[model samples]
Target: MLEVNHLRFSYGKNPVLRDIHFRAVSGEMVCILGPNGTGKSTLFKCMLGLLRGWDGKIALNGEDIRQMKPGERAKKMAYIPQAANPAFAYSVLDMVTMGTTAGLHGLRVPGKKERTIAEAALEKLGIGHLLERDYTSLSGGEQQLVLIARALAQGSNTLIMDEPTSSLDYGNQVRVELQLRKLTEEGYSIIQSMHNPEQAYLFADRVVGLRDGYVIADGSPKDILNEELIEKLYRISVRKVDAEDGKGRFFEVIY
Candidate 1:
């Protein structure tokens, strides 16, 4: 459903993404795996149209993303940042309602119909009970789920997440992971950048390994990701204990 072709970008004289190429299809979860400075976020910014200049092409469902209007882009892709900082104490429903207003006009407030959309989005994520609660008062996991619901309310089935679980604890991280997997099962194309190789191996249907601004490998995790690549990516020695349901993949510091 999404494709990046020969994408290249830079910050002044320093190039961050070089000749990056990949594609993500419907009902699939693609993880861009790399450590710091590997151009994962840079590539995301480029795809999201936040960064431009000297790039080949990025298309969403056959339409060039660079040529898409802001409203059009909002309808095609939803970005979930690593963390959310809400300045106002908006209710959970209120926060999600904002997403439903992407195509709304000026001086317009969300009415009952919009509220219904927002509520259904939350319900899809199984958090409808928190509708009236304050957004900032929820736990990190709940807050993240709310963010995902907000993205859903925007009417986009494709999600681009920048380290979606980066700020949450282990339990919440697992919770979000399960939700992500579920979303993909429900036919949402999810492209996420993550530092945790284990998460990629366990959760992602396909892995795009980025290192030094280049795509070193791209394929199924079990095929492209192994002990050697794990060490190469993070410069650390951990184990990739193959087991069922991705439950046995774990990492520990070597003495």
Candidate 2:
């Protein structure tokens, strides 16, 4: 449901992204993989219209995003950052309900329907029990899930997440990955920038590898991810092992 073509961006005279092109459709999970300073986050901002004066075309559901107004874009795309730190002590439900504001206009407050939507979103992520808890009191993984719920409650078809599993422990990382798989099954298009290539191999329908702000590899994990590509992208040696269950593959850094 998303298409980016010839996306080129720069700050002053220095270019960040060059000739970037990719596509994601409904029910697909696409992972953008790269190391630091590869312009992954900058590319996301360009897609979200948070940055302008960039060259290229970004279309959502067949319409150019540049032509869409802020609210209009909000209705079609939702973003989930790493983890949110709330200024005040707000309940999980309160934070989630805020997503509904994208659908409402003027001074109208969230009512039963909005609350119901938020609650449903939390339940879908299997975190309904934390609904009444203080958002800041939860663990990093819980906080990330709540943010995903908030994005879902916004009623967007596409979700863009920046390092969704960045700081979580192993168990929490698995939890988030499972939820992401569930979202894809339920028809939410997902694009996430990830540091972990193993996570992409395990969950992503497609992986786009970037180096020096250019797409170096793009395809299904089994097709594009290998020892050579990994070394080229990260400047490190690694080994890939097939899963015993035959689901997919995983990688390990050779020391």
- For TM-score, the strongest prediction is 2
1-255, model 1: which lDDT tens digit per residue?
Answer: 999989888899999888899999999999998889888888988888888795799999999987899888998899998778888899999999989888687888899989999999999999999999999899999999999999999999899999999888989998999999999999999999888877787899999988888888899987888877777788888765556665646666565
Per-residue CA lDDT of model 2 for 1-255, tens digit only, reads: 899999999999999998899999999999999989999999999999999999989999899999999999998999999988889999999999999999999999999999999999999999999999999999999999999999999999899999999899989998998999999999999999999888898889999999998899999987998999889889999898788999878888899
Pairing residues by index, what is the TM-score of model 2? 0.97
TM-score of each: 0.95, 0.97
Which candidate number would show the highest lDDT if scored against the true structure?
A: 2
Q: All candidates: CA RMSD in angstroms? A: 1.7, 1.1
Clashing pairs in 1: none
Assess candidate 1 and give its TM-score to the true structure.
0.95
